[model samples]
Target chain A: MSAPSLFLTVESEGGAVCLRLAGVLDYDTSDELAARADACIEQGPRAGELHLDCEKLRLCDSTGLSALLMIHRRTTARGITLFLDNPPPFMERMLSVTGTRHLFAPESGKARQSCPDEVRETTD
Target chain B: MAPPPGIPVTRTGERQASGVWSTAPHPVLESAAGGVLTEVNPAASRLLRGARPGVRLADAAPAWLARADQDLRDRIVNGSGDTDGGASGWIGARSFEAHPSRSGNGNVVWWLVEDTDRRRAEEALATERERTAFLTEASHVLLSSLNTDRCVSATARLASEYLAEAAVVVSPARGGKLPLAHAVGGQDVVRSLVAADPSQLPGLDEALQGFPPVASRWIDPAALPAWMIPEGYTGTITSVVITPLPGQGVPAGALVLLRSGGQFTENEQIFARLFAARAGAALSAAHLYAEQSAITHTLMQDLLPPRLHRVNGVEFAGGYRPAAAQERVGGDFFDVHHAGSDGDDSSLVVLGDVCGKGLEAAVLTGKIRNTLQALVPMADDHQRMLGLLNGALLNSHHTRFATMVLASVRRTDHVVRLRLTSAGHPVPLVVRADGRVDEVGTHGTLIGALPDIESRTAETVLRPGETCLLYTDGFTEARGGPLGDEMFGEERLKRALSECADMPAEAVVERIQMLAAQWVRGGGHDDMAVVAITAPRTNHLSAVDGHTRGRYTA
Candidate 1:
């Protein structure tokens, strides 16, 4: 079988919505990503939780990442919790290199407790 | 005795006795007793313009010798011990030492002197030579390494050491950290050149604001960093000239050099400025190169896992291809994950395309894949996974989309659940164990179809000897296809899959890439991604012992 296309998946956890992404998220897909994240925030919690699933994600460009940044800003301002999780090695490194790792997936104690297990159970 | 190099050898007898120990290209004079010419070197003859050796030493030397020590005369004339007592002091004179020639005894009192006026001329010559050597080396260093920070730091260090001036390096940090590159100068003066707060030092502030490689001076320390005034310098700074350091883009930071003792001369300051300017360009280029490399490296690493995750029962063979040749690689990728505990032979294989390409698409791809990995365990079925993925993608961002084939293979029961969803993406090709070629087209639109949209699952069994191939549009859309332009279309991919039905995932990817590559001659028209898995349904087992069966589950 051929490999699948990139994906940006989102969900709800605790008081905020969750957004997860897989595959290649780039300029072409960033718009869709931006819309999804916005929907999560506009829907409830005055904020949302962004969980980026990088396991299957293969690539991302600056523009794709910028979308994530936009989502982060939106959610943070509205008191949403962004818990980007399971980032692929590549995504994690990029986030760290660009100094945005903390902004997206803050350490658990930094904000609200991350319900990783809970999110896992729900999403799975 | 041999003379030092460049001192020009001279014979003793040919030496001019008229002046006191004056000789050689650059000389250090040691006064002899009575200045009666107890000894003379030939260098003196050259200095005296070939004056005869028999000329009276005392009268032939500068008349100022009359005021010299009386003991000098006593030691030379009477051979008394006082040779070591001779002292040296500057005279109110410039170049070309002169002496009075008397018609008295050849035992004349001589004079010894060195014109301090020539010191500047000599120093300038030396400085010029050193600067040339330094800049040449700097050029080489700038071109060799692709590290921006190192290049900048190296250039600054070279400037500081070569020019013996305050060389400062500054770059804007992403956060609040006020990270200054570096500053090199005299311990006392360099501190003022480096101020933690811009407001604390007006001179430095002006220098930083002026442009890169710019130099500015504070005639008084009142406007500079506090420590610069510890002793309170007296000498007025001569000049502060800022030669803007060029950054590839916007200025990252500025180099502030403060000269407190002697204001830099016009030529010296110009040279310093030029060096800084060149260094800045080199640093910018190096930074760009480094950034590109880091991105490439990161992309490559991100494309593949550091180590394989062992999925029970089934062997995972997947490969990811990002357009490495492109300026920015695409986000196309694939991954094989342990959807269940290692204790079980249930694995989830996700082969798909992230909507779009380049960095953004890559990010979305990563999110979907990671989310699937976290959620697949609880997903229970391909449909549940699709739902979770859809939900996660919908929440991750706005308007992001993708196409994918998520399959759960259960090795224990030799069963597979395959689902294909396209958010405007091409469908995957499947090859049965018996070489039955089929395309699972349009199971649904690609991912990110809509926040609430759910894709139907494609129910298919991976019988023994069956292999499935998942990939992105870059495959069927391979360039060189002008409508009917010989594109490596779906037909070609299906044919290739049918041919390599038994090959492992990695091998299948390579084979297809090779075929496509040969067809394209050299380049990949678009980013191509592939995933292939072969599960031996019925065991051709030796029945020899206990071997774990491979299993995959969704």
Candidate 2:
């Protein structure tokens, strides 16, 4: 049998907490991350910022992407900031392809390359 | 420990009392020098049935005095004066502690205090603890496995370990016949228990109606099924507990626990019911997962690319690997469809990746696949077919788009012609016979985004040992490096492809995939696909060929 597919590590940096994700993020393991995100949202007042560290993330399926979107919605509703840091190229491609890249703020200047905020809309 | 509140001790530190001794609530028996009961108090008369004047103390309660010597009373009063913290023994069904008191004239009075209530309370506590431990063990075993068969076996093992000498789990088969999933302990005993149909047993049908577990009366081994009562089987089967595994709305299975002689306790029956409930819940979950996987598998089969068949001059091998954890078919797919009949070889091979991974992308993938399959007749003109596919994608209201590579492979004797087009996808690679690699720089606009799609077709010819590879971006976008943030990159892929010098088409594809999978190392990578078309290498090449004689020299 395959081992548990997702591993999450939470670290508090400055006033923000970063959830570093490793292994797979798919249908079976996405719910756990969603619950963790919800818990962070519940502590919104004290949790200055919510950041998902994708540096160690190996893969993210549509369900994993949807979970990120859900967390974005929750944080936005609670008037908190959410960041997606150092996403791999394929994950960036998925967000850009699906036209949902604006939901999360990327750390560093990585967002300036490949897919800029401009040229996002296509000519009819 | 001190004496009772009103008891007095003499200067010698021995317990001495006057009226308190005779009026004590505990039973008192006095024996003279001859070991005969000189007097029996009212409590003593009620405590021991044979307690009376002129009766021997040992005769009144033989179990209490069995270890007592004739001088036991004398030793308790004079030698130790305490009877070794009082001798404890059972008189009939009651437990008693005998304390001896001497009256200075060599007369010893024995005080019998009943201890049955304390012993019964301790036994009850011990039984409760055992039940809790068993329940915890059963829970761990039942919930550990998602497999239905394993869950069934776990249930039976738990029943045998805690509730019975032998246990069996019987589940209803699709037909009327019943199939046993798991059995523990004596196989013969389990077989004999199965001899009598449980449905015909009295009160069993009602018990299975979501009622409590019911116990069977002592069953004669001779009355069991012939197979159960083997030759020289002398062991007698006493009783069995039948507990139903309640399903969603109906009972899914039954648990049978066997015993040889002892009657089933009420607590044991309750534990059996709880265990059955856990088994039922786990079975229900396993069944649900199986049903869902079946549905997903059917959808996946429909979305998967067809196997590549042999075209006379070319050997084709293609594979699709989905990066989705549980669902194998995501957005990346490839297909090889032959448009020409028998010897006249003309085939259309297309590989594409929808924008995302999952159900939505999978749905889009199916749409693109079906459209390409329908356009095979007109596929001879690669540009026109792609134009039609682009128009079809633009017509959909959703913003979903895909990157694709379309190849038209034609064979004439020893030579094969290829025309390739790309819709904003990565350029295809060609592996030369002498271990050199060339990139076919094909360019195009993204399929669904543009109204008038501009795509350029790249043409190339392959010798006998040459091969062409077409794949999605998942190949180069896989992320794993020394720093762990770098992509696998096109340079690594090119180097890896060059290593498979003289391998066959299938072997070439497998080598590349194996390298990529190793690089990914089970990390999260995008869905990947590769299609290799190799011309079989003969002893000597046909220098004078009928087809186009163009070479791609990187």
Top-lDDT candidate index: 2
The lDDT per prediction is: 0.56, 0.70
Residue B264 lDDT in model 2? 73
Instruction: Categorize the docking of model 1.
Output: incorrect
Can you write out model 2's per-residue Cα lDDT over A72-124, one digit (the tens) per residue? 76777688888888888768876664445666776756322312223211211
Residues B400-497, candidate 2, lDDT per residue (tens digit)? 56778898888766656788888767788888888899998677755664456667889888777788889877888887766666788888999988
Chain A alone, TM-score per model: 0.72, 0.81
Chain B TM-score list for all models: 0.54, 0.76
Write model 1 residue lDDT over B1-554, tens digit each, in one string: 12233532222323353233354343322233344343344545444432333444445444444345344556556876644343333333444332222223323322333555566587688888888877788888876777875676676566556664555555543454344544444232222233356546444444445443333443343355533322333444434344445666655455545455666666876787767667777877877787878886786566553232224544456554556565344666667665566555466666676645566666776687678778767645666666677776764435445666676666546545554443334556778766779866545534553444445556566665677777766676565643335667677778877887766555666787776666565555666777665665445342422144424333
